[model samples]
Target: MSSPEHKQLIWNLIKDIKVGMLVTKELNDEDGLRARPMSLVQDAYDGTLYFFTSKTDAKAFEIAQDKDVCLTFSNPKDNVYVSLTGKAKLSEKRDLIDQYWNKWVAAWFKNGKDDPDVAILEVKISKGEHWDSTNNKLVQLFEVTKSNIFESSTPNLGESKKFGTE
Candidate 1:
């Protein structure tokens, strides 16, 4: 079980990250992996990540065959990167979909929130790692310079931690 503090840390790392790369195994492709960008549906973290997709989407079919998936979120500017491994399941719950729906989403689904093809992809996170670093450019440059001058193997780049179950 993940501690509440760890959950909060995960949320803090990803709250502003609007998009993540959802990676899944490619069906009938000889152990290949396919990744696609997905917009985050929720602003707050709750151990599960949610995304919107169509029931007919290839990703949905792939998830049905293999639930194991990974989501990666990165922001080079802030030097924050996160990778999460989880099991994915598809849902057609209108109430849940409606909660996350917005005008931007409607652009993709012409039929709006009630679109029959609409589906929600829920990722129950098993484990995740996050790296967060200071965003100041000068601080980053100084860290690099200091590392070189001191012949240090470690640079003051960021903090990285692994959370959730093993």
Candidate 2:
């Protein structure tokens, strides 16, 4: 079963959201962590994130040793933000790669889907949390007027070790 609040948070942050930063720690622990913007695939509900990648990429190598992964999605215009945690791995589904293939991809990868390096990076999300910049100005004003409503209106749905207000 999924909590309405948690499910809503995920939908709001991901359903129409296009891009996010996927950050992974290096297995060497030699100050080699990495973060890159990605065209996010849909959440599989089984707690995983799917990313377009290549077989020989450093990201895949990192996942090979350290499976843990975290992704961040933020809307600067709305001030809404989400942090997703999971484990990452490379997938061998050629059909899935061809599905996302397009002209733009052709421009970037030359031969496009035919590239031998192409692969999918899948992240199995264990949990996620969000901080939403409330959309209702009237509601915000009401909260300010009531003073205590600030704590009531904002919802923190995940138990990340660190929480942010902005």
lDDT of 1 by residue, 51-131 (tens): 899999999999999999999999887889999999999998878898999887888999988889999999999998989
Candidate 1 contains a number of clashing pairs equal to: 0
Candidate 2 stretches with Cα past 4 Å from truth are 1-9, 30-32, 42-46, 135-166
lDDT by residue (1-166, candidate 2, tens digit) is: 2355555557666756768888888767877788988876554334456667877777788888888778888875665678887778898788877666666456657656778877778776667676765445655556566665555553432233322221
Candidate 1 positional error at 32, Å:
1.2
lDDT of 2 at 36: 86
RMSD of 2: 5.8
lDDT of each: 0.88, 0.68
What lDDT is obtained when candidate 2 is compared to the true structure?
Answer: 0.68
